[model samples]
Target: MDYLMCHIEKEFFGTTFEGIPIYQYTLVNKNGAMVKIITYGAIVRELWVPGRSGTLFDVVLGFDSLQEYEEKNASYFFGAIVGRYANRIAGGSFKIDGVTYQLALNDGDRPNALHGGVKGFYTRVFKAIPMKTPKGPSLVLKYLSHDGEEGYPGNLDVTVIYTLTNENELKIEYRATTDKPTVVNLTHHSYFNLSGDGTILDHEIMINADHYTPVDENLIPTGEISSVEGTPYDLRSFKRLEDAIEPLKDTPTRGFDINYVLNGKDGELKLAAVLKSKKTSVRMEVYTTEPGLQFYTGNFLDVKGKGGKYYSPYSGLCLEAQHFPDSPNHSNFPSTILRPGEEYRQITVYKFSMEG
Candidate 1:
């Protein structure tokens, strides 16, 4: 495996309310693929992958300058780790072992904790440690969440490793341990625009999910496992995202933003979804050990992105692998609780290739 790492001096928006300076590290693979990540929020600044013609194009939406990211509120979250809890917690509250805990509500009057609240892991700057492995160059990021930081229990120490292998696989391994029992569901939120030129509506997507969690008007799951058959949510087989997005444009969020129950065994890696962009002939295969995948079509990206373009809705898509939303509240869903004796581990891989 070919391992490559280079340190470049680049400035970025700071973590505090007052803008500060941050650095960016670029990791490139032998296949001419590369990912630029910054220390601020550990955000993925850009990602370039090879196309069918053996050309490289930036596929992830991001900003060119720190000022742009600060002013626009346009955090593609691009390729950052989201955690504590990956999805929404109803009313910013959940009961664990008969103990009710209140969380920080940041989802705009929804009264629910969305994506780990206002000061989520995405908003924190992680400590990056670069390592050389047999497969490739990897970066291990560690973050410590103090008890009651986000109104959750325990002091959580989380580690996420980003490894770009020689086989064109971007593997993310998540590990965490808490001093007290807590809810932990972490995933990498990478907005992907495989076509590299236009919106993701034309991209063909195939999700191996026969059921999905029905959401309310606020985009919170109603704790029901509804069949995806005959609905716009159906993607059991390969289908263009545009074909099913037109009708749902009038819904609450106005796009495909829902969690799908993966039809596979838990705790074992299995194919989650396959995405192909005909324009660039770029294909990506997603595999994970999680039980569910959240498909978000960049429903709120109307803000300005890099290069003076207002990123319209559906400009990018994210497939986050994790346990179902509100799993702590829903007994039917997979358990997301991690006691002191148990360890949390999850692995997800995005393998890129091109179609002839």
Candidate 2:
């Protein structure tokens, strides 16, 4: 694990749907923490960090090859950047500036548009720039979405930077601007299993949220911000996911896939969540500037990932920091609108460590 250079390397990942070339960028920090990101969809294919025993393990679940990522239909998002709008949009329609826009109904039988109507940022190739930052290695990804590309208004220009600092922090900074009013809720979809090969059910979870947005059967927010007082959604203190989710295992929701309203100022980066694997003692602290965090246990993960690994339900978990789900349709929730002349910026940092 010698990282004297802390170099940023690149290699060919795969081609796009249109047969365009795509590249993978590898960033290694001074402490030997490594991360691999592909230009196609700006996907984070692998992230390796040291465990308590000084063993490096890939914490994020992803396909071994880009071909698998391209051919798979049920992505579960894996380790990609999902955007335009992250969660479900009710009825696949929303009103902006007194005009109603209809999107493609991609979520079957749900009457909603899931993850930006099928062709979201997670499926598109992006322009990447590798760089050497003052603290460590970094890469910047840029993409532009034309007006009405996915039945959404505005020509949006977006830039996201992934920086690996010497202190073992994977910092993600997102900035965007639009020409017309549109809904924008960008979030990273990374299924994390800190123990590398085991289920995340034994992982301890802690969320800094006093309330959460309840959802319907279709997973759309009901526009009510209810307190997490006595419900199973309470993760204010550290609790094993297995114990926290056992009560809801028989319900319609099945498991944890709800959005918790972060307790803090919306625009300031604050501690949102903390996840630790009891087996490996690998800890990840999530800090974000967003208003909410979507905590999803990989309840539907049935894909085969890297090294011929078959991922089962609850194999991994996701802590997606973003705005509330269906924020555009719910006027009571925090707004996800990006108006003309206004800039959209959010920062989320995943700092990793080992518990002694």
Candidate 3:
């Protein structure tokens, strides 16, 4: 198949250390929007979208080769799917039906678990199937997590679909089922810089959240659901990212790394955030079915990205939509527990456009 103009194209990416063959799927839309997804980690390797000048620019930050991901993704996450649980779990421990499960202490200070312990969905090679749909091109990725893997219960079968629609929307749908009770909070970890280069401090942003979860020094939720009023976390209206970060200069959160309680029902998709870059005039609107959105600025980034470009702190930002962190321990938070015969589902869309 001639892939130059094809809506969907698949090619061999690379082989994993386990001798597993991985493939990359490229999905192109009628609007010149394109997305490259790889079976390894079910990651979005690149995203090219039209800007105000009608030029397509790759807007996400990632590496050029599979080896780079294999070596660097453990710290960066990049555009991979983070799963089982997305954020920090207090003391790397949680209880299910009065039984405590201990996970790896992989986060800061070695007191909490981050993104499903040492091995997460981000490290797995998903089985990929590329197909054409009426809406556009879609790639389905599936992975199975065995019981006791990463100290989590049950054999969980997870399926994630990445669809590039005609409207320039990168849609992600996640579904899972477990044989026994388990807690799950999956989210996509994509660091986006709409301008294609430089720090993301100038990006204009807006989040549809009235309250946010307060966190401690460990970045674990303190069980307080506080209002965003009179706080830098308030982004109910459009505000420049630099301005948003200014108020937190002297605070523990030098930059945003907190979860916002989104203003919408939990089960239905709704607008979560909007980000725009004046340099490129590209606008990205995020919609999700989850009740919480983790807005994190790349505060510790200091690495070379694709094309050997040096990425400094705040080079990109991540808006992770998922259930609240440490949900299993917080009785007041939304439940993330999945039981036998029950299904876990979530959808998040990153829709793009250009402003003249």
lDDT on C-alpha atoms for all candidate structures:
0.82, 0.90, 0.92
Error of 3 at 75 (Å): 1.0
Per-prediction backbone clash count: 0, 0, 0
| TM-score of each prediction | 0.93, 0.97, 0.97
| lDDT by residue for model 3 (248-268), tens | 867766799999999989999
Tens-digit per-residue lDDT, 144-254, candidate 2: 999989899999999989998888888999999999999999999989999999799899999999999998889898889999999999999999999998998898666
Q: Tell me the tens digit of each residue's lDDT in model 1 across 302-334.
A: 666667656788989999999998888888999
Best by lDDT: 3
Q: Where does candidate 1 stray beyond 4 Å? A: 4-21, 70-76
Model 2 TM-score on a 0 to 1 scale: 0.97
User: Model 3: residues >4 Å from true position, as ranges?
Assistant: 1-6
lDDT of 3 at 172: 98
Better of 2 and 3 by lDDT: 3
Query: Compared to the true structure, candidate 3 yields what TM-score?
Result: 0.97
**Preferred candidate (lDDT higher): 1 or 3:** 3
C-alpha lDDT of residue 4 in model 3: 30
